[model samples]
Target: MNAGRPELSGTFGAVSSTHWLSSAAAMSVLERGGNAFDAAAAAGFVLQVVEPHFNGLGGDVPIVSYSAATQSVQVVCGQGPMPQAATIERFRSLGLEHIPGSGLLPAVVPGAFGAWMRMLAEHGTLPLADVLDHAIGYAENGFPLLAGAADAIEVLAPLFETEWTESGRVYLPDGRPPKAGALFRTPALATTYKRLLREAATAGGGREAQIAAAERAFYQGFVAEAIDSFVSSTAVLDATGRHHKGLLTGQDMADWRATVESPSSLSYRGLTVHKPGPWSQSPVFLQQLALLEGFDLHGMGLDSAEYIHTVTECAKLAFADREAWYGDPDHSDVPLDVLLSPAYTAARRALVEDKAAEVLRPGSPEGRTPFIPEQSAVDWPVADGSWMSQLANGLPTVVKATAARNDTCTIVVADRFGNLVAAVPSGGWLKSSPVVPGLGLSLGTRGQTMTLQEGHANSVGPGRRPRTTLSPSLVTKDGKPFMAFGTPGGDRQDQWTLGFFLAAVDFGLGLQAATETLAFHTDHFSASFTPHESRPKVLAVERNCDPEVIEELRSRGHDVEPAAEYSLGKVCAVAVDEKAGLLRAAASPRGRQTYAACR
Candidate 1:
């Protein structure tokens, strides 16, 4: 409950969404002669097995790594692409009008595996098999489930029980969700892993191995068949289906490929920041930083009426630009030039009413909206006109929910070597598909991020990845590694990341102090793609915030709900202290436990 703490001291370390992964991978990397990148990859691989309800091979990873040797930083965008066959007309033919909460539609060519492969090829010194050894062993043997994971399993079981092609395998041992702490494994995933190694060996080059294996195993091999059949089943192909009009075909899958993009960035408060273009608000958050420099943050004080009011006011101003000018820059001319210009920043700052909350301004800015067209995908084949929720492990929730990757996980590895790897591979659809035995992995129903709306900026289209809010971030000072961090709560990721990064750099707070300081988020669930997509009616707060602070926020024109745990993007991080030659790290304290290792 304390606001400030002295933690994250060490020479090397790692963290995950689940505790088992947090400890196991850190230990494995330390055992090897490898450094942070190797350990992070190992941890990522292990998470797919042990924490499969969210994130597996079937997800995307946008990563940032810092290299001390070169004193340079690099960011890779691995978010996947849409199916080639996707189209707005496709949805009409399927009698569908909106994206489903089950995350069963708008599935793309998963890119996380490819991202990992690329990271290893360019930066990792250890062998791929070696990097993944810990994960494979956990899948083949067994790993204990953490408390939160067990609860997630119970919470999403009902939704996954009878849906999807692989339903029987995940839900039925004799047909039931496994109890908490039960050992789980997945042989299918194990085979997939081995297949990758064999492909890696015979592949023309190291780079080709990861791609070849992923394409062969998931797209062209058994996984593809299972997926194709699942997509073509009576449900998705039905005239009345709620998801896409038809299941996926080999051709659609074949059209899928991971794309590499140039990083778009800007200067804010003397720091350089980068984010993907088209559907990312990194530029907007950056502009907010530039404008906030003019404000007297210390005068307003932390979490005071003026502070929250000012931040919220600035967020509204940024959102105004976001709603109108932020979209896929390739498809539309997002007014980024004008939006990020100094003129706009100064003008917006001048409009802020210091003493009174401006409750009337909407997120949309003046002039033409720059967002590109959004089309609906086909998720047809319905026998029943009605829809229902399938619980996973009978874990009760405080919110109404469809499903996303609630079992979200993160990994940060820093070694004696200069390279660093911090990744968050996440997205889980349900609980019914229990963690399989021997595979240590779960399938991702990542279709949830797509828009069902006919012409929204974030739509399901052929050859396009959905616009995602999950971003892995890196920070550097004077061209050297300083920190790598991120969180998993959908839209809340940016808000949390923005808060902590500012606190750490601007105010020079320690890791725990920066992370634990009062934080606020602007977007409500009402602003999301769907309402009731999460547990209902809660303000998702750190349990330790002073009760009066909660009351004061409630007094304002905002809803203040208290959470006893981390809700929006559970953050995990590692920062390199060059002077000390150490890697300081910590995981979200909202969980039962998370371990950090140092040499």
Candidate 2:
């Protein structure tokens, strides 16, 4: 095992998250006799407060979990659908071809709050107030600001001050970004949560009723009224070079709620891996596994050039399929079964060659109509025009931006009762949209993932869920829960998690060692963000990887770019050894904020 960071072990329970405070909050819940669901919910709420630049109350979350009592796994689909007025015609009327990356026009019904509450009410032992205590405390009292969050505030300070005054009020206390490690508080957000609790208290019923009441307050009560009033009253400038009012309304929020669904999974090498359905880019991970099943990964060596090349190529192919076929299954007829079939995987695997393929190649599943939107140049302009300009020009920019505004948070919790949950909560970054007045939250800009082209599976339409990139991973071996792992890279979430999984299972590395290993990702497929740019045959590897390996990849027709050692991914994971009654958890050191705690 790698000696850098030891894997945390405990018999009682463990929690790992993208932030230390959130991890500590989860551990506190577990110590207080809460199960994995409760701990996860606590950590998730705390993450919203601490990692405000990554997620917020207006964000969406997708969770894959295992219940010890039922001995079954399920997915919590928290991604909200497009507003009733949000359609291709509306966007076209605004003279836009694609949804702007940052604006009210891209806002969706907030989904994370509903999803977290549902998880708590269905599987947790504690009440909504208990699970929300950590978040409320942090927001009310104050917490040390992280360097990443601070940097984000600094970068967007100009925009915040000039265009997004509400955001400036929350992020910049004295007309400036708070320095790293400085104590910071968002009293507005705290007040918002307190108001929800007060509304819940008025329900005068059981814990479930209280939770339901809180949900109603958020979706249909004061919170909804505030959002509707604000959006209706304002028109903000967005990436489309125009000011537009939001499409969301109180009726939209009242009509939507998170739902439970089956996970998309595939068995491989004695392990069964599970991910959220096509609505997310998760199934791409399973599809990658299917293609890799035919390879001898062990003999190739973990850090070998051949191994990296093979994995990169396979990711390109799978992600191409994601762009073409994967979408909200409720809105599109995704041929998931045919895509996951062994025969189909074999044919796809056969396309992987020693040399890199420099094109988008999505497999044609029999009898299924595939929809690949025409790749168009992204016209959305970044506020600063820094790294985004390079990306817009088809040049390789570092993945640091993926860690900043477009990033998400990952949580893996395992309690003493054997309940396990892996969730990726994301969407409402400070850069995505202006902060909602009074609520101190922003609506999600996930609608940027939808296409304007009519009839496309991921086309923007009323009530259609955008194909999100937030995918969490859960694994099982021999009919028992084995691991819950995830990371925070928009299109690279599954790519990084797959590398960590293979390192542990195929290379026999421990959780910590596996996560700390060199990370890399390919931009060969269409990106999930606005402009949907694709850099054919481009591969980015961390500087920690051997220079020889990088050179070898370039020699093989790969446009290899060197990234900062710790700029790749912030992956966190937890594993259970039921036979030994031990739980092991690990967090990536890349971002300096992720943490793993066990006791």
Candidate 3:
């Protein structure tokens, strides 16, 4: 297969990201002799500045990393828990059955900063100032805005001005949204970072101590004070069309910290695939792989009717389980061991029929009953009428209009010494919540992923993590680090990443070729966000797919919809060839800003 872009190859290091600037920043760190963790941390902060509509400093991140020295793979659990005041009763008092997708009420303890700081202090060689320089520069001096950011600002301009005035003050200058390619600056965000650095400098310790100081400033000191003051003083309009105060407080931030945990893994074809545990939807990827291992995927041609149908069916089963059984293990019994066991996967694999199944069916494992939420008849009004109206015109509109609301950013980095990091930094999108006054940041709406239904694994509760769709991928071949990859899609993250992995591993396609191949996903399970909607048996494939395959899928009881060629995913990947001591990277051409850098 001719990959639209040449696969990047380097002898020393490589980086791939959803944005060109972020990839370049990571590559620069690599050239400066920083390890993969340092490069990834720098790239992550840069992403917050360049992809403001997709992520920000107030967001959460989940990271998977491998170190040659330890020869172990670990997860950075950056998905923050709901605040102390976040309770089902409090939401019910406000007449809310589900958390709103855009508001302070759904804000969790911000996890990105704490996660990055921990990674830098423990595994990285660079100082906090070094890792944050790129982001601070872009925030203070300005960076060229991408078309997507400009378009999002344009769409949300009216809402910002009327309902989120603080956001308007930061995003719009002179009362107008910035145009694409225009230099945009957020001095307030730069100031916030600078203040943290200054506090770190005052600590008068080595690199580790300085990093700890910065972390304290963010969670226990000035940053926390600002966030607490804003939320305590304001009542803002959210997706509920009601003004509400936030549940998060300074104490909540002080109580939370990112921690390292063992990753959940499954072995297939002599490779071990790793993902975060049940706190995220990551284990669903491993579960799908377990089920897929029983099949001869190589015999099924790529994107063929049979191949697409089988993959879609397997995904439906896995996501059904995610909706039912997956949650914060600290709060719920996830039953991951039984869920990933060979016997259980074999049983789940038996459910995949030649014909598409148009229902949400979660199977019993170890005689444990699945906790599927009852489908509510309540109809919530679409937050944006014009955008929702456009969805009826065509299949492509389904993704284009909804992409910003459901998108995240991915980063993957590899160093010559055999260090690897794969991270998905997301949440706190510009449109998701109001910007914190004078901080140039917005709180995450991840709390929207929780349910109000009692006894459910993912029911809303204080200090519980909502089920997150942000997942990154890592694989080791023959006990050696092989690849790190991920993409930016809400529910489609695992689907797209799984396709990319299978194309490369099963069919022997190169990174670029695998990433560029036609992609498809199904909306069979309830969405992870607010107003959880489900479109049973619906499969949306890109226009690049063979028309015959599309028709054949439609013939197999699939409600097939046509997606634009470049609208499916924004995947980025890096592979390390241990024997050859070379690094390879690839970034999807689907988006204008995605890029790969190697040096």
The full ranking of all candidates by TM-score, starting with the best, is 3, 2, 1
Weakest 10 consecutive residues of candidate 3 by summed lDDT: 389-398
Q: How many backbone clashes does candidate 3 have?
A: 0
After TM-score superposition, what is the CA distance of residue 361 in candidate 2 from its true location, in Å?
A: 0.4
Can you give the lDDT of residue 141 in candidate 2? 97
Clashing pairs for model 3 are none
What TM-score, over all chains together, does every model reach? 0.83, 0.96, 0.96
Give a tens-digit lDDT track for model 3, residues 230-313: 999899877666688998999999999998999999998889999999999999899888888888888989888999999899
Winner on TM-score between 1 and 3 is 3
Report, for every candidate in turn, its global Cα lDDT versus the true structure. Answer: 0.56, 0.86, 0.86
Model 1's number of clashes is: 54
Task: Give the TM-score comparing model 2 with the true structure, all chains together.
Answer: 0.96
- Candidate 1 global TM-score: 0.83
Tens digit of lDDT per residue, candidate 2, span 1-599?
22288889999988899999999999999998889999999999998898887889999999999999989999999999999999899989878877777779888999999999888888989878889899999999999997768877876677678778898999999888899899999899999999999999998799999999999999999999999998888998676656789999989999999999989999989999999999999999999999998999999999789999999999998998998898888988889999999989999999999899988899899956567888677666654644233222211112354422226899999888988999999877777788989998988888888889988778888999999999999998887899999998888888898999999988999998898988888988777776677788888888778889889999999998777776678889999988788999999887777889998
Q: Which stretches of candidate 3 lie over 4 Å from their true place?
A: 1-3, 377-406
Candidate 1's residue-wise lDDT over 1-599, tens digit each? 32233466766454433455645676577677776666777777777777655567666677667765656666566666666666767754655565444433445556677677666666666767787777778767777765555565554444345554354365334556667778866666777687767666666566445546645655566555555665555343111223343334656655555454555556655666655554554555666676787887767666565566666667666654554445455544566666766776787788776433433242323354444223233333433312233321111121334222233566666666666666666643233122223332333434445555545555566665566655676666565666777766555566666677777766677775666666556653223333213322223445456677666656655555555434433566777788887777755553444445555
Ranked by lDDT, the better of candidates 1 and 3 is 3
Model 3 Cα RMSD, 1 decimal: 2.6
